[model samples]
Target: MGNCCGTVIEKAGEMGKITLEILGGGEEIGRLSVLVSRNNSGILLDCGINFDENGNPQMPLYVPPKRVKAIALTHAHLDHTGAVPLYFVSSKIPTYMTKATKDVLRPLMEDYLHISGYYLPFEYEEIAKLFKNTKTVKYGEQVEINGYTLEFINAGHIPGSMSVIVNVSDKRVLFTGDLNLAETELVYPANYREEAKDIDFLVIETTYATTEHPRREDVEKRFIEAVKEVVENNGIVLVPAFSVSRSQEILVVLRKYGIDVPVYYDGMVREINRIFLSNKAFLKNHGLLRKAIKDFIEIRGWQDRKAILESGGPAVIVASSGMLRGGPSSYFLRKIYDREENGIFLVSFQAPNTPGRLIVERGIFEEGMVERIRARVEWFDFSSHAGRTELLKAIDDLRSSLEKVILVHGEPDVQRKFAEEISEKYGLNVIIAKNGDKIVI
Candidate 1:
């Protein structure tokens, strides 16, 4: 880590007004970064990255290190924390995140570098520098830096995920970073009632602006029944889940419903579970997580993985890389996909061109590889973001003090429709920002 970076590149604004410069995640869901500045000095929120069509890493628009007084991370996801280390390369900027987030983030970043470091800008040294200058903030705690008060509120998107409140010059701005309004097996829904009061500006995520998720109980029941049916038939049930919250959520759900079949977990999920276990205070229901962990077997090595796949008895396997992008899930898939008795249940959002989406839509694993997949394929909507009705309710709950609404972290077309609807219903100024747009409030 370096000391004493450059001078501020931007000028001071009006005392009461805040300038928000969108660096990324304006028109899309990933690579989310925003600069909140007042009087020349400001903080950077979530310097995330996205992958291009060719699978290249895309970082946020670069801002001079001196221009930012602090960097606030929302969670441990790579999309929100990936590019943060780049800032640490030249400047030892204070990076703020929950202590639990810090624990999970290190392993995730290490895994990311191990897999895709060649395509990234920063290296292991930068990641180490990031932690050297790190400061941990607890939920509901407020800290002041450079004349601005920063408050971290639980976002309920994942363990240690937070929605931020930036207070400066008597103006209050809320940035909802990937929040959930519906409770899951892992964490409670985002509840910021006291925090949402009298907000002057609101920057919210609209990931599911147009879609409403199914009932959580119903989804869990369906998932459980499907697993039981496959297990009863003596067939392997492979569940591809995200290594983070989704994998843990699925496990808790299985344990809640009393799924007695042998369950095995693979890939990075084991490490993530251990992190969650060590930070039990961050979880809404750690007892269930403990029970799930106790019941499930963690795949130890290549030998254990092959034995699980070749075992005679029917069992359920939950693996990482939810999209089947890259993980042991693919190995399990290639081995069992050709069998009709086997089932492939996807529990996470499958981005376009991913193997999970390909199998679900076209019965193929990859684009060019046309192997016929006879296994049963199904996708469940276990989203961790607020859906349409929930999003509307959230706005209604906070509209009493909201002045202007800025929508981000969603598709452009979906954002436009959602913006229009929000504007019409609430009669508030709604803005759908682009990647580089700046809004003053």
Candidate 2:
């Protein structure tokens, strides 16, 4: 659990056995990376890049590059696979992911580096090299590499996202990388079958462990009502969503309800949508996406973006950056801040210190420029992570076989609190991991 930059020292020497290490996703929500090592071979779960001020890569974890044998990217989210190219650029490791993740991530990563204007950590040629090194794995198929057997399960977080199950010798570990038990119109629900009963270690995400989200049906009803209310009032509704899963989910919801309002896709959401379309086979409800693409959705161009502000009577505009950092959402917020007729609906998880949280919680937008924006602000907690109750349920579901539980992807306080809750509630051995912490199985 030490914060040093070297191999974690284990008590009683190296167990000369299989072990799991927390490379990232320890005390934070993003930048999820973990190493599962047995003997001398290692398999990385994810290689995500954290976003810094200005939306550039802030890679803090170091993996010695060469020590990594292969990578299993859980999804295409930047926080899950953004830093993958960095591995290819720096080292020679074969990466594996669902075909959908690769298709979606190829453009997203490049677009991120393009818009940020920061010197890209990896060049385009390097990305091609990374692509060549990547091998696509289908769900449920087990692949053996470097003495470890790996299987990918549907994570339910996003299209093509997966939870990695690793088998090494006699030990088995399941890494639930950003799981969502709730079903969505865009994707199938998670598969937490009885077959997973044999897992020895369950590495779970505690991102929303302190809260419980509304039922999916209730959420959909509220979302439809909110959009309808804004439209009836002749006001513009601005939805700030993540460019990947959240954006696609919102679009599907809008399409499902027969909302004829002009839906403008702006910022990276449009590009990400294109990628989603490209890999339609990975989508859970491909029929719905195809239907929406054919009938309801309208892709916006740069000039068309201004139309959302100027022309409009009752329109639904979904844009990113979801956190309101520096995307079309920020520009739209600044434009509509002073207008009482406008409504801002937050449909994603807003991290601490992000602008989206500030706008919803405080209603304070920037330092006074004379007038205060009094638009009605409402939040719908449609987070992709499992909630507190769901986390406990997941733990209980696996109790019959799981021996040890390792909590990751949350703040220190939250992880500690959840760890205690797990121990008390299930009488399980829990490990609250910090960065670089390792546990032998």
Candidate 3:
């Protein structure tokens, strides 16, 4: 791995006030990159890529790498880390993320390159170079870059997710990466530390600001019961879940609750599970995780997948792409979707305009669609992000020290309403970040 192979202009841009320039993920939920600058030092919060209207992945517009000491990665999600390898390929800017994040990210980037024809402009060599420059920092570790200190706090959305804290020029700025307030069976909820009590500038994620998620246990129980019903009727239960923590969480929940039916998993879930198990230090219960992995049958070969689908129902099958964005999950659904006894369990959030959302909302896959999937469709809220009440409580808990509030990583309408409500409740005005907008605090 050529860890160091690029050059970038270095400068600590003017001093005094802290500045944050948004490159992406201000108006939308993806491609999260923000430049934090104070005095002569600056760093990127997250450089990610989002999808276009035509269903293609698109990176944020290029920004000069000058004055950026390093890129502080908060997690391994594509929406948070997609642009890293290519954007930094020519610059080789040091990238920082949790050790667990690095482990998961390697596989994600490799998979992305293999599947994406040209979405990722960088080659495999560039991914290796990005890895070489990437430095893994543990949660709560302080990283110093050009007279500034950066710290990572557990974000609880997925394995290795962290909220970023920057300390510079006697001021502290907190950037909440994708936030999770409820502890899942896989990971603990975001930890609100005493250090997080007082903040000069607060950059937070309001992903579910307007929506309230059901209790974690309740959601799991309902989903498991629905699966049990389909299984008892000799129908297959197809659960489309994210290959990361979502797939693992569904597996653990089913097995721990004594669901005896055979459960099978396909797609990248198996590989990601291996990575998650090897890094049990970041999980909630090591024993439970191991048992969950052992409990499920891993499906790797297409022949095996077809065999499982042909075997006919009475079992639970979990696959990737919670939204029907093309993965083994869609195949599983197509196989058993015609039967009224069979069911498609949506155990995760279905992004707007995605196949999953269409099925849930419209009950049809639309023109040129694969089968109508007339089977029963059920939705379960297994979201890992904080909800409206929780978000308000968290903000209120630290309001006494909150000087400036900025919201990111959410839909424009959802965040705008929440921002107005937050400003009224706390009497501190809220700022909504837009693409290319810069706020000086």
Candidate 4:
């Protein structure tokens, strides 16, 4: 009904009772964790972490580790899996995720610790234990743990990302863990119609519930055109993208659109690309990525970085921390910002207060030193989340069996607007969740 933090919102029913506790990611976009329980045992959905304005790691609300029977990870993104190692400090409960997710998580976890270890509770030992307890599951595989049956289906957000269906006591609850219904060069569109059938409850993400993205083809075309223009004019183009999937997605887009220029990738993107290449089944077309890799040069060390920057000819560099918080992208920006010929093409969401947002909105970069940038900067909506149209369509497809909708992982204003529309159009009960809220269905 509202942002019910530390409160229980229960539907009175004598049979088929299931309880959901929101430990985090209730009214936020990150640090998502949820506990779903039937009877006395519970399953932890995601053990993630959030960042404070000063870039400190903020963990989710605590759920006693003993009460949780198992942990299910939707993907390997830091916001979804960063706090998972903390659970391993005391509990070795089995963690289930896709094989690709497991493989991709190691480098990310290592990097996260290298950056935020001082503020974290767990260490590398716990991370090792976390992996020791991990059990990989493929798409559509149903595995029973304690009293819950979990089924993982492709989420289409990134490679190996999934939506989880928890079945217990004859009730079905679907958790849309950062899903995307839009098709991309990396993964196929998430077709959840078949899996949504007979789902009694839907716990959905509203990351982009208030907006609709432009057609993928149109966006791709425009992005390619802009890149080609920069390359042809003997200028440098830097694309700061997420290391997980966005960086690789952009490379595939460049190849698909026939943008033949010197391409160099820096930061942790090279590691993520290797993980994606080895896990070929999780991708839409791994061959395209392989081909792209053959053409692009990897910035192995400072020597390679300097070589690319010192080159006279035009080149495109793709790097990580899409928001330009702190990565090789930031270093590259400092070198190229004063040049009018260079361009910064941001292909991911720029959260408020990040360097990427500042450049886009105010044409400035303010990390160590504030500088008025002269480089042409543009942002593309290469989000891997379902937009308003896709979200409503998902609800319409599952409306027959959906009784209650609980929205999470969006700003408060966006969730409120989305909740109102769902309530009016579908005439279904909708709840805008906050941290520490429990719901019964």
Stretches > 4 Å off in candidate 3: 1-14, 193-195, 369-371
Q: What tens digits encode model 4's per-residue C-alpha lDDT throughout 299-364? A: 898888888888844999999879888889988988898888889999998878889888888888
lDDT for model 2, on a 0 to 1 scale? 0.78
Model 2, range 97-205, lDDT digits (tens) per residue? 8888888788877777677666767777777777888899887889988788898888888888888899888778999998888877788767676436588889898
| Angstrom error at residue 257, model 2 | 1.7
Tens-place lDDT digits, model 1, residues 1-441:
111111122333556557888889988998999899986569999999888876778898888899899999999998888899889878989989998899999999988998883567789999999998999998889999998899998898999899999988888889988989897888878877765667788888999999989999999999999999888999999999999999999999988988888999999999999999998878998999999999899998899988887774488999998999889898899889988888999999998878898988899988787667998899999999999988888788888888788888999888888888888788877878777776777
Q: What is the C-alpha lDDT of each candidate?
A: 0.87, 0.78, 0.81, 0.87
**Could you give candidate 3's per-residue lDDT for residues 1-441 as a string of tens digits?**
111111122332445767877778886888888888876458889888888756678786556766678888898999988887765657778889988899999898888879885645778888888888999888778888887889888888998899888887877888988888787999988767554756677788888899988899899889888888888888888999999899999888987898888889888998889999988778996678789779789997899987887777688888997887889987776677677898899988887778788889877654477667778899999998899987887787677777777888888889878887887677775778877666777
lDDT of 4: 0.87
Put the candidates in lDDT order, highest first. 1, 4, 3, 2
Model 3: pairs clashing at backbone N, Cα or C within 3 Å: 12-40, 13-40, 14-39, 15-39, 236-313
Q: lDDT (0-100) at residue 151 of candidate 3?
A: 87
Count of residue pairs whose backbone atoms collide, per candidate:
0, 1, 5, 0
Q: Please give the lDDT score at residue 248 for candidate 4.
A: 95
